[model samples]
Target: MLPVTVEHAAQTPSIFLESAYFNFVLKAVYHATKTVLAFLQRDSVLYWPFLISTLAIAWLAWRVGSAAPDPGTKSSWRAFSRSHLSRELWWHPSARLDYRFYVINGVVFPLLAAPFLFGEQVVANILNSLSTTAPGLAAAGTSTGVVITLVFTVVFFVAYDLGRFLAHSLLHDVGILWEFHKVHHSAEVLTPMTTFRAHPVDLLVMAWGGALVTGLATWLFHRFVHSGITFYTFLGLHVMIWVFSLIGNLRHSQVWLSYGKTLNYWLISPAHHQLHHSAEPRHHGCNRGFELAIWDRMYGTLCVPTDVPGRLQFGLGDDTDGRWRSVGRLYLWPFRLLAKRVQGALQARRA
Candidate 1:
């Protein structure tokens, strides 16, 4: 592996800028549209299965049940689409900031993780030591077939979800972290793109932490149990592809698709996530799980929604001072806050 030297790190920013500007920015509008479509159709939170299912259920409910279309709207479909895809929200300057940051993540996060990628060797060494001390662990490194591979896939998904749940909780509980996390919550409207509105700092931290957990789990599974059992991936992603294609995109959508009282205890619905984004003080820090509600249930953070969805106002409320509304401030202001925090800490120490 190549060493991550000062010269390499220095060159990364320029490399990223050149690649991002020429390769990314030049085609950003196209990519951004593609990205939004993908979110709506396949990946991230919104998947086609979930979308079709929600639409089908909503249509049925409108035709047969008390759930009716909004009074001013032409139909239920139009009302639902208008609520989630209003031009003001989709074309908001803030949404553009999200696309820009998405491009930045594509370029920057890999460079940031490059140095730490070498730590895999250290983890391998530790696994070797453990295997040497525990002969049973040596069996873990042995090659295995389809059954064990399936088991490993289950373990991988659980570990990934656990990491996401922890990182999300910390983002809410920690002040400095919340400063960065607030960017996602600052969106006044809910769109699939709002899912990408994450601040880079928040994204990087969660990405690194989640990657570490996943890498370590993978190493342990391969080292101790079955080396041949790898991720059960579809389109190069783990089970999340199914999750996204099923009901994941709905998590960030205005659609109110709940798994109901009993099922919600097992699976998190789109309504569960929309409730999490609710600006109500009661909803703050309520549902933190990414793909599962079991974590929230385990941690006493779960709040099941009613059969009827409630109206929600999204955003961070008055604490933002409107600074979060600007793309420039969204990128720069977090660093400024961090600097002030460091200076204050230094002064307190001296006193």
Candidate 2:
């Protein structure tokens, strides 16, 4: 107590760190485990209900898929297993990258990327500050009326769908953004886990886009109508989104469940998404919408699927697909490509 010592001062930080490090590690592990466990819950695509729905749809697709016989329906179980479920396809080097991407994006990406994510509520609050509305109109904090709730539900759902589709199209059309999104399109084979195989940057962009549009819609509703309305939900999810989740898993699978020609014009089926994944020249940038076809149809990007299987091939269809077969490269290559583009631009400018 009488004399200040350097050893004592240095030891204080070490002692405090040693005391806290164990609990910090334990807390991190606990949260990560909890997040991974959510994969099995109803909110997730890997949930039993969704997976079972995919199976039922697949079986039905084989027995009776379209109004008429579909070429995809003629595909045998052996062909489906070989393409989608085989030891070769599932265990391929490219699919191994997807597995690693799934783990990283699921367990690690959310933690590191949370601070970068924009919340729709936050966006709405910002927009609300810029606009003036009658403050005394209805109770601002409380919700009322099932009809209003249902309408809000549909509106919010459409907002989300529009945002998602627009973001997806931009990722295809924009050169700079495509560098990051290319990680997803590089998958050679599709699986349930492939749905999770996205670069964290890709997820961040999509999240921000969704938040901005949905938040804009939220502000409009609050300004014109009342802030006392909320969307209807099913099991803690938007009713429309929960319904979409039933067949969502099949979108990245080998299963072909088309909504037929007529509905295909209005809706996007699993077949539509498979075409989106296809590396063919004509199929590139086609069917980018998640559920609705109107966005794609209006944009001239819609390609109504004909339910023919085995015609489409996946991946970038070039050397990059093989070169980025490792998960580490999948993460780093986008940055490297961006750097190269910057370097090239500078050199050209100097020349």
**What's the TM-score of every candidate structure?**
0.74, 0.87
Residue pairs that clash (backbone atoms under 3 angstroms), model 2: none
Per-residue CA lDDT of candidate 2, range 1-351, in tens?
Answer: 547577776468777697588766775686567656765676777777778887777666665634114457345665444545679777878778777777666666766786798778999999878655546344345557777777788889899999999888888888778988888888888777788778888888888888999999887887666675778888777889989988888788766678876999998988899899988878888999999999999999999988465556888766676677777877888999889988998999999
Q: Which candidate has the highest lDDT of all?
A: 2
Which candidate number would show the highest TM-score if scored against the true structure? 2
TM value for model 1: 0.74
lDDT of each: 0.69, 0.79
Q: For residue 105, what is the lDDT in candidate 2?
A: 62
Off by over 4 Å in 2: 2-27, 65-84, 133-143
Q: In model 1, what is the error at residue 345, expressed in angstroms? A: 5.2
Clashing pairs in 1: 45-248, 45-249, 46-249, 140-224, 140-225
